[model samples]
Target chain A: MQGLFVVFRKELCDHFSSYRFVILFGLIAMVSFITSYMAGVHMKENLEALSKTRFSFLMLFSTPGALFSMVQFVSFFGPLIGLVLGFDSINRERAQGTLIKLVSQPIYRDAVINGKFLAGVATISILLVSIVLVISGFGLALVGVVPGIEEIWRLFIYLIISIFYISLWLGVSILFSILFKSIATSSLASVALWIFLSFFVTLGAEVAANAIAPMDRKKETKPEILIKNTRIKERVSLSSPMVLYSKATEIIINPMRKTTGSIVMMMPMEQILSSRFQNPLPLGQSVIIVFPHMTALIAITLICFAISYLVFIKQEIRT
Target chain B: MDADTIIQTVNLTKRYGKQVAVDDLNLSVKEGEIFGFLGPNGAGKTTTLLMLLGLSQPSEGSASLYGLDPLRKATEVKRLVGYLPENVGFYEDLDAIQSLEYVANLNGINKEEALGKIDKLLELVGLKNDARKKINAFSRGMRQRLGIAEVIIKDPKILFLDEPTLGLDPEGAIWFMDFIASLNRDRKITVLLSSHNLSQVQKISHRVGIMINGKMVADGSMESLAREKFGVGDKEYSLEEIYMEYFQEV
Candidate 1:
């Protein structure tokens, strides 16, 4: 535990002092604050249409009409902050010839990996929380609104889950760092995985579902095949951290969003959801709706961290 | 059971697939002795040093540091061993003091105690003035000097220096050797110096072990190896002449 803290403190300093951290901090802050400004500007246009929720302060971050809401921007690009911060964590040290000397110290190998991981997660959490508070402040200044206590509580949960999402990506990049000896190779692998998971996965899933179970309105398609196709596509999309993050954050930030998947399948026929915009679910129930997505993100993060730890301990530094 | 023997290896062999890196070897260094580990490029000096440090596992046999097996009790072994790898580096952004403080902290030394020791070490290594300078601005010789201070940070009983003088200029090399000799003489720190440079090893080492083709071809005092290779005559031979005497073939 002592060694872990020592490593963690040193690594935290490295992250903050690095240009990578500065660039990531600037990029996220700029995008998030800009999205909040845009969302606040557009919220006035659809004030009456939004319905019932007088305290829709969350909408300042989740604007429906904008090309990109702040929340959406975060859900999309936030993982890159993690990827960039951690892509070269191990390999860069190996390349610079510091790992050998580091491991030679009277410290266990596990502490090295654990300390780096904890430090990365902590840095990301701090950055995200500050950005969240900044966006909230923008909403109040631009749109003449302050979030209710309940909205603030929900936003806090949103921040926690987003950190989890980013941690998973951080774990992945660190694992790549351990697997590849060269910093360039590890970074390339991390970026390639990021692009595939964040953007192309959704497109690829849809194409794959179409091939597996074609959907044609012109010819009457079987209901089972259509359901199968949708299920396969959903399964593929769920593998991506972006999809998981987007799903969980959507419900957390927007109270009116009831279910993550099809509302028809989840609700029975007798308990009919009204055709009108339904009353928003309570904060607790909203969290219940996204609990599975949160669990999946955390699970993947732990699994990746564990694999990196084991591989690191087994690897020969001299080679 | 000899208390004077600080490092002992019995039939230590490291093989990678069909190629062997270090063949079965039996070697030992007495406490406070400077043992020069001389070998050609592929003779596995680095590999042997790594196994002794518990950084690599041997394919056969075993090694012990002060009677503790490195592979079995690495933390205990590491606590008493300080290693200076070839071309060592520090965090480029950190100054010499910060880097040394980090190393001290890693070895569980408190800052209060480490501060005084770090100062003394920097002065000894001729890096006291550059203690505030970042490692990025340091020349290769300076990093090597810093590397020495880092190696002795914990006051370890044994020192494993692999190619310690590889990049230093002649004057810098002499300075480094003098420092090592002082540490060995005053502090009784056992030194295992591995290098392909035979002359540098000849200058500081109390004994020499020559490795060729993954096996020890010669192991004894310089006089014994010289007398054996150059034939029993009252003659002084440089390490290069003795080296050619054995490796004159392929």
Candidate 2:
């Protein structure tokens, strides 16, 4: 633990001093602030539409604007911040001939990986907190409403979820760093994997859903088939880190969000509508709603961390 | 192992598939002695060093540092030793003092202690004036000098330096040698200097091990190897001749 702290402190300082953090912080801050302002504006329209005189100002974070909402933007760009910070974490040290020197210190090799992962998580945590505070503060003025206590609690939970989501990407990028020798290879491979997982997965999910449960509008008149198609489509897309994060964040930020499943056969139209349009589910319900999504992200992140740790410890430091 | 031996290896071997990197090697270095390890390219010098540092596992046999197996007790072994690799570098953005102080903290040295020790060590390495300069502005020799400071930051019981002067100019090489000699003599720090440069090794080494094709071809003092190879009372011959005699291509 002592060695971990030592490595963490130095790594955090390294991030602060490096241009990588400066550029990422600037990029995220700019895009997120812009999205927040737009979301703040859109929250006004949502309030008037819903005809709710009193709603959670926290909804501003989830309100979809002309282009994108803040949480959507976070879902899109959060991984960028994570990948950029971690793609070269270990290989860069090796290239600079510092890895041998580092391991030769009294600290265990595990300390280095632990410190690096913690530092990345810490960076993501700070970035998310700032985004939430800024957007929430700005929402108060633009939307002319104070957030409810429950909304504030949900937002805090969302922040924790956001950290885990970003850490998933950090873990992936660090895994590449250890697996590859050159920084160029690792960074390029990280970005390539990011593109595949973030963009292609969404497209592929649609294709796979169509193939698995084709509409076949001609004979498949059964409503169950359509329902199954929708569920499969949602499942395929939600498997992605982007969709999982957006799903989790959307429910947390928009307290009104109720169920994540499609229920045509299970409930009559009137009953489904009443439940869906009902007042925001209790805090516990909302948490339960997103718990699976959050767990998947956290589980994958831990798996990545585990693989990187095992490979790094067993790796030969020839130089 | 002798009572005075700080490092002991018996029948230690490492092989990559069909090729052996370090054959059944038996070596022991006593406390407070400068042991120079000389080898040609692909002679398994770096591999042997890696095994010693517990970075790579041997296919057979074992090695110990101060009676502790480095593989099982790596942190304990590392705590008592320092290593300076060839072509060592610092984070180009960090100044010398910042870099050293950062490593010192990793060694569990307190900030106040690190600050003071870093200042004096930088002076010892003749890099005191460049403490605040970014590493990018420093030359190779300056970086090597800083590498020395980083190695001794915790004042380990022994130092493992592999080609520490590999790329230095003649003057820089001399300065590095003098600095290392001072560390070994004045501080009584055990030194294991590995290099292909026979002259530098002969200058500071009390004993020498010459490795060829993953095996120790010879191990002894200069005179001992000289007499043994060419018989006693042989005419003058530098360590280079002794090396070329065993390694000559012709």
Candidate 3:
């Protein structure tokens, strides 16, 4: 434990002092601030246009439209931050020749990798939570409204789940970083994976699924038919983190309220509460749902760490 | 070869496909002796040192440090040995002091004691004035000096230095040799130094092992090896000449 802490301190200090962390924080802050400003503008317009109507503040909760906008922005930006922080974690050490010095110490090889992974996760968490707090504060101040207890609880849950989601990507990036020897190669590999997961994978899945289950060629598809098809497409695409996060956002932004004549429309208040967006599952079930993602994150991180440890242990310190 | 042997290797071998890096080597170093391991660039000097330090595994045979198996007890051996790699580096953004302190912490030194030792080591290496400067801004000599300080921070029982003065100027090289000699003499530290700088090794080492083609062809006191192999009866023989003569025969 003492050795781990010592390594952790050094790793964290390295990140804090290096240009990588500074650039990452600056980039995230810029994007979050821009998104928050846009959200405020849209909220103000909605309130002004609806002031003369009979719609109450409760109507605002029905869609939690502004909060969903923030979620969408975060989902896109969060993984970018994760990839940037993790893509060079190991390759940088190899390039700089610090791995030799580090492995020569009395500490266990496992401790070095564990300490680094924890430090990376901690740095990402700090940056992400700070952004969340800032954007939330800005939203509340601009809207001149305090969320109810339920809404606040849902938002907190959403943030926690988002952390796990981003960590999954970070773990993947670290794995690639360790597998490759050059920083450019590792970075390019991580970015390429990110692009595939974020954009192309879903499109490919859609094309494949449609090919497998072709639509009827004789009849034009109805709106209801399209909406049903879209939902099925969404379920299929949720295999990727980006798509999973989008599904999560859909659940949070639109919750079930009262049963309508046909389509069960969520009530305005229920929408607000749901829009704040707790995990779709109950506490226990949420854990089950998140456990696989968390396990995948942890498993890949350890595998990369183990490979690095083995390599460091066996590598001749020629330079 | 009794209890006083700090390092011992029995038939230690490393091979890359058909090319052997270190072949069937048997060697030992006494507790406080300065043992010089001299070899050509590709003669497997670094491979031998890496195996001895538990950084690399042997394809066959075994090695021990202070009676602890290097392969099985690497962490234990590492705790008692300080290794200075051929071209050592630190986190380039950190200054000399920060880098040393980090190494100290990794070695389980107490924070207060580590700070005191860092100061002493910086002074010992004549790097106190440049302690706060980042390593990226340092000269090759400065980096070498800092590397020396880092390895000696905990005052480990054994010091394995691979080409400690590789890139230094003559003045820096002499300064390093003097410092190494003083450490061996005054502190009784066991030193296993691998270098192609034969003259410097000849000056500071108590015993020298000359390796050629993955074999220790000659191993003894400098004076003894010269007398026995190079016929240094009345005249002194330079290490370069001895090395040339040994290789010429092969």
Candidate 3 lDDT by residue in tens digits, B48-128: 887887778899999999999877787898888888888887788788988998898888899899999999989988998
DockQ of 3: 0.66
Give the alpha carbon lDDT tens digit for every residue of A1-319 in model 2. Answer: 8899989988887777788888888888887778777777666666767676345576577666658877888888889988988999999998887888888889988999999999989988887798678777777777788877887898889888888888888999999999999999999999998888889988998788788878886775567778777777787888688888888888777766666654553468756675767676678888898899889988988998999999998888864
The CAPRI category of model 1 is medium
Q: What lDDT does the true structure give each of the candidates?
A: 0.87, 0.85, 0.75
Q: Model 1 chain B, TM?
A: 0.97
**Candidate 3 interface RMSD, angstroms, 1 decimal:** 1.8
Interface RMSD of each: 1.2, 1.1, 1.8
Cα lDDT tens digits for candidate 2, B132-202:
99999999999999999998999888999989888899999989988888999888899889987788888
After best superposition, candidate 3 residue A106: deviation in angstroms?
0.9
Which digits, one per residue and each the tens of the lDDT, describe model 1 over residues B1-250?
Answer: 4778879999999998999999998889999899998877878988999899898989999999888999888888889999999889788989999999999999999989999999999998899899999999999899999999998999999999999889789899888888898999999999999887788788889998988878888888899999988788867998878887777653
| lDDT (tens digit, per residue) of candidate 3 on A21-63 | 7987887787667756665666677876756533122223233
Best by lDDT: 1
Interface RMSD after interface superposition, model 2: 1.1
Q: Which stretches of candidate 3 lie over 4 Å from their true place?
A: A44-68, A216-236, A252-319
In model 2, pairs of residues that clash are: none
What is each model's TM-score for chain A?
0.93, 0.92, 0.74
